[model samples]
Target chain A: MSKEYVLKEVEFWDGAMASSQALRQAEVDIMAAYPITPSTPIIQNYADYLSNGYVDGEYIRTESEHAAMSACVAASAAGARVTTATSSQGFALMIEVLYQASGMRLPVVLNVANRALAAPLNVNGDHSDLYLGRDAGWINLCTFNQQEVYDMTLMSFKIGEHKNVRLPVMVHQDGFICSHTAQNVAPLQDDVARKFVGDFEAVDSLLDFARPVTYGAQTEEDWHFEHKAKQHKAIMDSINVIEDTFEEFEKLTGRKYNAVESYMMEDAEIAIVALGTTIESSIEAARQLREEGIKVGIVAPRVFRPFPYDKIADALKNVKAIGILDRSSPGGALGMLFNEVTAAIYTNDTKPVINNYIYGLGGRDTTIADLKQIAKEIQANADAGKLTTPVQQFSGLRGPKLSFFDMESSK
Target chain B: MLEIRWHSRAGQGAVTGAKGLGDIVSDTGKQVQAFAFYGSAKRGAAMSAYNRIDDKPILNHEKFMIPDYVLVLDPALAFIGNITANEKEDTKYIITTHLSKKELLEKLPNLDEKRVYTLDCMKISQETIGRAIPNTPMLGALMKVSGMFEIDYFKNAIIKVLSKFPQKIVDANLKAIQRAYEEVV
Candidate 1:
């Protein structure tokens, strides 16, 4: 039984504090983490809770993110509920172990403070790290603000630990924008939150003396392909469990969520598709534009993994044009969001004119004014019934209007 | 909607002050947001903190703002901090200075003297809290200028916020707050 704690009806908290509180309430068995910018506070607060007798858990001070993930894997395999947090470079270091954790079907919940990959050396918000892990075989949940960060983190444990979906989960929030911004948050009572998360049930525990289990076995070209196929199937099938979990969470806390969220799209002709904190700003721009008779809308994927193709397509099928905003640099190609969204809606009878927008790299501010401009440009494309600008453009970049790919020429 | 920007050094508790103000404002069942721009800044490095308060939930996450109130916690920042950047025509300034309002206005020719308020927060905090931390005094001055909360009600709420500290320290902070609240002009 968990101890009961009195909580205010509402309290002010940053995304990091909210995440740490959720982790504490879940009564995690262990947390092994390496301190990194923006994300350090999540584990730091959890460690403080452990020291102050508020939580009963082991806090491992790992030398590096690689060691941290390795420790989580070992502990989770030993039948303990494990978790951790990291950011840009640290997440880059853990990429190798991330595959191992998911391949082993260990349900370790990882909180990511999404940041830009360093080259010029910046510690700011971007989607580079989050996009880097899209192929790592984890259920990725994207949050728009501090409240969602808290809710998604608490629910990640339940979703990942479900018997039908025994896979790792990643909850991502934009660094600084969500992680460092303080706002009002309503939290559940400790006992209620604990009961909602439930206990971790170990299946085929390595520590079980009566029944032994083997992990990390090497199956060469003979069986590796079959194992990967099964993993993919599990991820695809886990959507059922995810929906059920979201429904149950809504019942408990009246805050409804969906795999794909659409705002003001009932009769919209132009839409902006984005993720992370940009969703909120885009929504604000959409509202402002609607008042000016611009018929704009916003679409975002709450579940970044498994793509939520059907929901996204249904929400966006009616729009005439779309501006897909990608915060990560595409290196030398159209943005990843552009590629995925195009694929999702390509099968529709009437496809919307989709354009790629690469913006907000390395923590550059994405203002409502900028989003409004993107929406207006998309509106122009909708009215013209053709490509009005390049297929890909860089927004908010200083000096020079850099763009590429001419749709008319390609056609 | 009301927006506020604080100009201060990193170690002077500007971030703490912003969060504290958010905490206080949130109790009224309104929406509030507080954040700071921390770009590898060391202690004593100049930085700014911001706040947004409104009746409806605030969804804007951009750092750019046309602030309604500009607060200067360090006197030097009044002249060198670009305090007037993105300020509105009616934006009010609350600055910490040992000099009179007229004296400080002469130093900052671009500012409208009528919209500026000044107090010696350093002197107030040192006399009452036995230190030079000016964040609490600045909050006191804000309370006095904005009239957001009655002095007694604000003090009681702040006491709860500072409950984790020793009673002696809490009492000293109250004195600093009260002194600045009465002294700012």
Candidate 2:
């Protein structure tokens, strides 16, 4: 029977309920976290669960994210399903041990609400935090909406706990987009989530008292390389497990998802590739452009670790030029999404000129009008043969236009 | 398609009103969509909820550049921003104010004079329900302006949502919905 989960709709939430419902489905046995912007509610929600008897879990309010990950590592190694969440510099603080959680073969799932790292501070949605942990050995995935956050949080546990892929996973949601924006989400029923995830077996094969042995052994130089080599192989094998897990999740719940979902890409001439909330807005833009007899579509990249290179390349074969809409600047380099598009193109003939767009820095809004502006720029760049080696231009931002209005006049 | 642009700050329950309106009108077997464009991404910031009630499925998800009807739950918003941006010659503006339509329009002369219908929704909210969540109350004023449903239909529609609360609160809210339907001029 189909049931409607009547969540408080879009603007009413403080993100506490999203975190609460996810924690319930995760059935988290251990929670160790420090509070940070846009992600404080995850801990607050878990805390409420503990006090109200909504869930039976030991919630550990740690001093820092580093300590939190360390506690999660310990709990998972000792046969407990663990979850810890963080954002901004707090998420960046876990980069050191996050790698170890994978190499040590622990299945700790984390909720990373994406926010910008500091120089000038930002407290809103962006992917800089998630990008900083790209090589930390955890399987990283991004979500666009609150529904995806709830669904992906539960799916992360299943994906991590798969025996063949005993690695940690990070389910990244744009801070305010999914976290703060409330929506009606169909949460996983306890019986179904428990049945699917099953019982978690601790990684230590010698966990049995009868055959106790040392774990995390200090090895000679020769064994160190081989051990790390196996960890790399397991992380790579997660690609297959991710697909299988989705299949199982679909059977349990009637929702279908993918590593890379292509929208209206059949014989598309121009494609805008991006991730997170912008993709939803971009899809609407693409549909509108299609109505006007323009051949356009969106390549929404969901998984970031493996990057779904082959899948994206195969789909974009018919398309000509592609625009990479990145929310963050790569400084002297091109935007992050632009580089990924180039890498995905196997051949130069099939490779479209990828225009790198670094738009909406410091949590600026990316409206549908802004999306149309990007499309116009992409078309112009394509026409002028201007996309040469990933040039980053100043993008659409609201303030006094600096073209004629100098900042000194204001002071 | 009759598009209504709902103006409210975050946590003020305009989104709930949008969904409730969608549910109530959908019983008439009309196609409807309810969504919002949020801002500041916080507990309290200016936000806009939207509804497109039509005989066909709504394809446009963007905020309406020109809305057919405007519902303002906050009276103070009149001073802060242009709450009536998309008002056509025939568009109706149902605003929650402490004053009558003429007095409020005299204060906010920027608003269109031809089709503005201002009611004291806060008084309706306070007197009928004993609280100041003006979403249901403004819906009463909207019912008067748009002439879509009877007061009883909206009362039943509100009952579906308010049933989740305690009986006393739910009954009060139902009474508020009913009174707003009759009382709003």
Which candidate comes out best when scored by DockQ?
1
Residue B37 displacement in candidate 1 (angstroms): 0.6
Tell me the spans in candidate 2 whose CA falls farther than 4 Å from its real position: A1-22, A46-50, A184-188, A205-208, A211-224, A346-349, A381-390, A399-411, B1-69, B85-91, B143-165
Q: Candidate 1 — which residues are off by over 4 angstroms?
A: A1-4
* Candidate 2, A371-409: lDDT as tens digits: 876776666555554453335455575564322212242
Return the TM-score for chain B, candidate 2: 0.91
Locate the minimum summed-lDDT window of 10 residues in model 1 chain B: B105-114
What is every candidate's C-alpha DockQ against the true complex, given to 2 decimals?
Answer: 0.87, 0.20
Q: Tens digit of lDDT per residue, candidate 1, span B1-185?
A: 89999999998889999999899899989999999997899999999999999999999999999998898999899988999999888898999999998888887778854489999888988898888899999999999999989998899889888888899989999999999899999
Model 2 residue A344 CA deviation (Å) reads 2.1
